[model samples]
Target: QCIIDNVVDLKVQAAITSIVSATLAKAKLLCQDVSARGALVSCPAGYKPTGCACGMGCGSWDIRTDSTCHCQCAGIDWTAARCCKIGV
Candidate 1:
């Protein structure tokens, strides 16, 4: 049997930032591609994460009818508001 010493192997926040950035970048590329093709781009302007809820919260980025990403909080109805992506 072997034991391991507890040590900070990596900066979690920094890693998270990097991962998010890259993910957004890739998403942007995909959006650009769709837009370039003159296709109707849903949520062209992009939406921020907000208002999460255990009930229909999805706890993650959700696409509203207006085509926007929203992280709804507990008891916050995302359907209440629309993203309204411009130039879509």
Candidate 2:
């Protein structure tokens, strides 16, 4: 009984740790994205800044040369986006 209880406690701790780590990583990525966008917005025209590629279909809008702009919804249908069906 004692051994089982210890194992269960360890499993709970591991799950909590994993969730915290994942949340931190996501926050960090969001911060970086905001910073990059701010820099792009502040830059003047013809000024080139390099950063992550646009996620949507706006590939022509060069991140290096153009100001910061989010990808349009027309490009990718994220609403219909799916990961995996049941049995493929």
Candidate 3:
């Protein structure tokens, strides 16, 4: 009885693992870097900004509408955003 239960558990685990692997193989995270010569930059369509960086020694920043990166510093030279999206 114990051996039969162990075998059944093994089979269930295998099935769960295969399902997870198949789902992971079908979906992927695609990322891109966008930069511009100004205080603001935006991710491309269908992409969202995950992080941002600013030039001219500026550290203050924010994301506008979940897409654009805005640097809150005067005389800012550039801004960049790390954008990502999920795709199959």
Model 1 backbone overlap count: 7
Which lDDT tens digits does candidate 3 get at residues 1-88?
4798889899999999999899989998999999999999999999999999999888899999999999989999999999999997
The global Cα lDDT (0 to 1) of model 1 is: 0.38
**Whole-model lDDT per candidate:** 0.38, 0.39, 0.94
- Model 2 residue 80 CA deviation (Å) reads 39
lDDT of 1 by residue, 1-88 (tens): 3333322334666788899898766653221212111111234356422222223534544545654344445443433222222231
- How many angstroms is residue 27 displaced in model 3 relative to the true structure, after the best TM-score fit? 2.0
Give each model's clash number: 7, 0, 0
Candidate 2: residue 18 Cα off by (Å): 1.1
RMSD of model 2 against the true structure? 13.8
Better of 1 and 2 by lDDT: 2
Candidate 2: residue 49 Cα off by (Å): 23
Q: Which window of ten consecutive residues has the lowest lDDT sum in model 2?
A: 79-88
Point to the candidate with the largest lDDT: 3
Give the CA lDDT, 0 to 100, for residue 29 in model 2. 17
Model 2, runs deviating above 4 Å: 1-4, 28-88
